[model samples]
Target: MKKTVKLTVNGTTYERDVEPRTLLVHFLRDELGLTGTHIGCDTSQCGACTVSVNGQSLKSCTAFAVQLQGAEVMTIEGLAKEGELHPIQQGFWEMHGLQCGYCTPGMIMQSVQLLDRNPNPTEEEIRRGIEGNLCRCTGYQNIVKSIQWAAQHKNQGQTEIPEASAPKVDPQPIAPVP
Candidate 1:
């Protein structure tokens, strides 16, 4: 039997009839046209398909669409507001954190969750928080730097915002490690 589900994604509401076995990631990407959420692995091992359901970071691949009833889903697309990029997205861009860009969306989504929980995350905290999202680009140096930059920018709000929808790096700021 098909079920009707209502998903509030990226500040938009979508209602659809789907099977019980439909994966949330597939529903988001294929059904809702929210392609920003990518699925790296179906085993829930990689955090590439991560999303925030009601403000908690989770692996979308392992979740069923039916389970998310009445849940407010926040994907990477919903991170920014009024053309402003999320600080996390800016962190990756300015730090040159991405290479192939496969894991970026998930990283940004997870970063939002991290920031929502702790706006200012330390290097170790950031690393531990994003341990699930794997990136084989830039050797993760830029990724760490990106997160650090976003933390400082979000806290201060002094950083120039090029893309309001997704923050870009500020010339790749290299902070001094104390």
Candidate 2:
């Protein structure tokens, strides 16, 4: 049996009928077409599926979609506005916080809550804040720097990085390593 779930995501309200067992991560990615919420570990260990649920950071894979009735969810896509990047997104871009980019969305989502709680978190505090999110690419040095950058620039509101000044990324499909 399918249950109807209504929730507001990224300032948009959506109502859909989904299976009772559908995970929120799957609901977001599969149904809502919000693929920014990645699914790395189904056991909720990796924190790759983290999203903001009613102002709290939560691992989307751990919660069923039906469990979030009338919830306000914020995915990575929600961070930006009016073609401007959120401070954390800008930080990640400027600080070289991501390498593979697989974990970037979740890391950014978690960092959003972290900065919300403590806008000017210390280096050690930033380390502790994102401890749950595991990044196999960068050793977290740049990630920490990225969060610090956001903390410093957060009060400025949406940051508009000029196109010429921003780094140019040529995304090519990765060929599997034998």
Candidate 1 local lDDT, residue 51 = 92
Q: How close is candidate 2 to the true structure, as a TM-score?
A: 0.88
| Worst ten in a row by lDDT for model 1 | 161-170
What lDDT score goes with residue 173 in model 2? 50
Tens-digit per-residue lDDT, 101-160, candidate 2: 988999999999999999889888898999889999988878887888788777665466
Model 2: ten consecutive residues of lowest lDDT: 169-178
In TM-score terms, which candidate is top?
Answer: 2
The deviation in Å at residue 75 for candidate 2 is: 0.4
**Can you give the TM-score per candidate against the true fold?**
0.87, 0.88
Off by over 4 Å in 1: 162-178
Q: Assess the local accuracy of residue 89 in candidate 2 as a C-alpha lDDT between 0 and 100.
A: 93
Residue 16, candidate 1: Cα error in Å is 0.6
| Model 1 quality (TM-score) | 0.87
